[model samples]
Every structure is written in C-alpha cells, then in structure tokens.
Target: MATPRLFVKGTVLGYKRTRTIQRPSSTLLQLEGVNVKEDTGFYLGKRVCYVYKVGRESRCIWGRITRAHGNSGVVRARFQHNLPPQSFGATVRVHLFPSSI
Candidate 1:
C-alpha cells in the first residue's frame, strides 16, 4: 500500500487524457523543474505539474499556489481510468534529470 510516487523526471508542460466518474486514468505529467530560490513561496519560474497516477484509478496529483487567488497556475490531475497519452496539440520534448545520488 506504500508505493505511489513515480515521476521519472520533469518538464513535460503538456498532456491530457480526460474521463472520470466511470473509469480510465493514466497521468504522466510535469512542470516544476525551474528553481532560482527566493523567499520560499514557490515562484521562481512559476508552473506546477507533477501528476503520476498510472492507469487504474488511484489519482492524487494536485497543486495550488495562488498569490492571492488570481488563477493561471493549476495542475488538477484527477484520474479514474485513462488519461496520459498526449499528442493533441503536439510540441512535446521534456527532459529533466539530476537525482542519482
């Protein structure tokens, strides 16, 4: 019951496989690979995405950080059966690594 934290890497700012309430869910998302370090409010580069709930309805990839509540940053990955095979708009090429210590 303790094995759900898969995020090979990061930087994939695009991907969506919608469908819920019934079934089908697969999420391989990213967007949080740009840090400059400030006061510690998380706004260095601005962009949050880390949803890794591979197909089977076990979703739990949420995100939130509104300065006051304007809205433009959100990664609501609510899966239930199938969502993660992107190619809708096309422009994918996300590669980020640095965790092999």
Candidate 2:
C-alpha cells in the first residue's frame, strides 16, 4: 500500500492565462488557505467559488451581453493532469502544487 500526498485548499481567484476563442478561459484561482506565496492547496468539489473579472479600478468587467445585462466570465483551476477532459467544468476537489512533476 502507498500513502497519498495531500494538496492544499483555497478558492479560485482568476482565469487561466490562456482562453478558448468563444468562451472565457480558465486560469489559476488565488488561494486563500495559506500565505500569498504558497503554491499548494485543495478545493472541495461540492461548491463553486464566485468568479468576477475586474479592471484596474476593481470594477467587474462585462465582456459580452448575452442577455440585457449578461457578461462573459470564467473560473478555472489546476489539478492532477491525468483526470479526463470532461472534468474541466465539473465541480472538483483538487490538489494543486507549484510543479506538475
């Protein structure tokens, strides 16, 4: 038997540096579970962390108006790479670290 390494915990704070052409791309969410420089954490798959894109003034930026007042935004996180692609949007519990290897 082998022991599993535990990841850290926190909420998503931003979008992934790269994005899809038709939709908001996912990015690294800033973690609140530890110091600002710490890179390890985990998330409970059952809940969603609110995602709001903001500008220099910290005002929410509305990329598009799908409805009368709708904005295009996104939330993303880094998890074990072996997980399937469908797992991208699904609520997930993740163990994140500084490096993939």
Candidate 3:
C-alpha cells in the first residue's frame, strides 16, 4: 500500500526578499487552511520538505519552520540548502512529526 498521507501541503510562494535583495536562506510558505498568524504557532519548528526531480532522479531538501512571517498564516523556513528559484510556486510537504503533543 502507498504510504498514508500524514503531512500538510504548503506552497512555496517565494524566498524572503527585501526592497532590493533576496535571502535564499529563508523561504516563505503558506500552509493549506491556515489563514491567521495564530494558526501557525503549532507548525513552528515542524519539518518541511521540498521535493524535485533532476533527470531521472528525485531529490528532496529538508527544512524547518523558523517563525511566523506576517499577520497572515505564512511561515518562514530555514533549509539545509537554499531552495532553487524554480521552487517558487512549487508544493512543499510539511511533516507533522516530532510533534509536541
């Protein structure tokens, strides 16, 4: 059987950017059904994964939610490696493991 779904899907809106610069070290994500900042509290420190394909190989970059980005539910994440620019608009998997519950 296929692995059961146990994670939330998030969107890779883009990297954190300033007026004239972009910081790839951090990325901004909006989780499904999360519309308010308070809803993001539970996801903080949660694991995030960006999966992609290169040639015939599938690769994944792991990261963790660092903090809430704004009044909305977007959260900031720091990854082991900076995500590619192409990741913009891509889908990310937010694992609910390592739970504090």
Off by over 4 Å in 1: 1-35, 38-47, 56-60, 65-101
Expressed as tens digits, the lDDT of each residue in 24-79 for candidate 3 is 99999999999999999999999999999999999999999999999989999999
In model 1, the worst 10-residue window by lDDT is: 90-99
Candidate 2 on 2-89: residue-level lDDT in tens?
8764543333343333365422243333334433332221232322223233465432211210111112122243332222333333
In candidate 2, the residue pairs with backbone N, CA or C atoms under 3 Å apart (3 or more residues apart, or in different chains) clash, namely 8-41, 8-42, 9-41, 9-42, 13-29, 13-30, 15-27, 16-26, 16-27
Q: Candidate order by lDDT, highest to lowest? A: 3, 1, 2
TM-score of 2: 0.25
Sequence-dependent TM-score of model 1: 0.19
Clashes of each: 5, 9, 0
Question: Candidate 1: lDDT over CA atoms?
Answer: 0.32
Scored against the true structure, residue 84 in model 2 reaches a CA lDDT of 33
Give the better candidate number (2 or 3) by TM-score.
Answer: 3
Model 3 sits at a Cα RMSD from the real structure of: 2.2
Candidate 1 residue-wise lDDT at 17: 38
The model with the greater lDDT, 1 or 2, is 1
TM-score of every candidate relative to the true structure? 0.19, 0.25, 0.93
Misplaced by over 4 Å in model 2 are: 1-5, 14-23, 38-92, 96-101
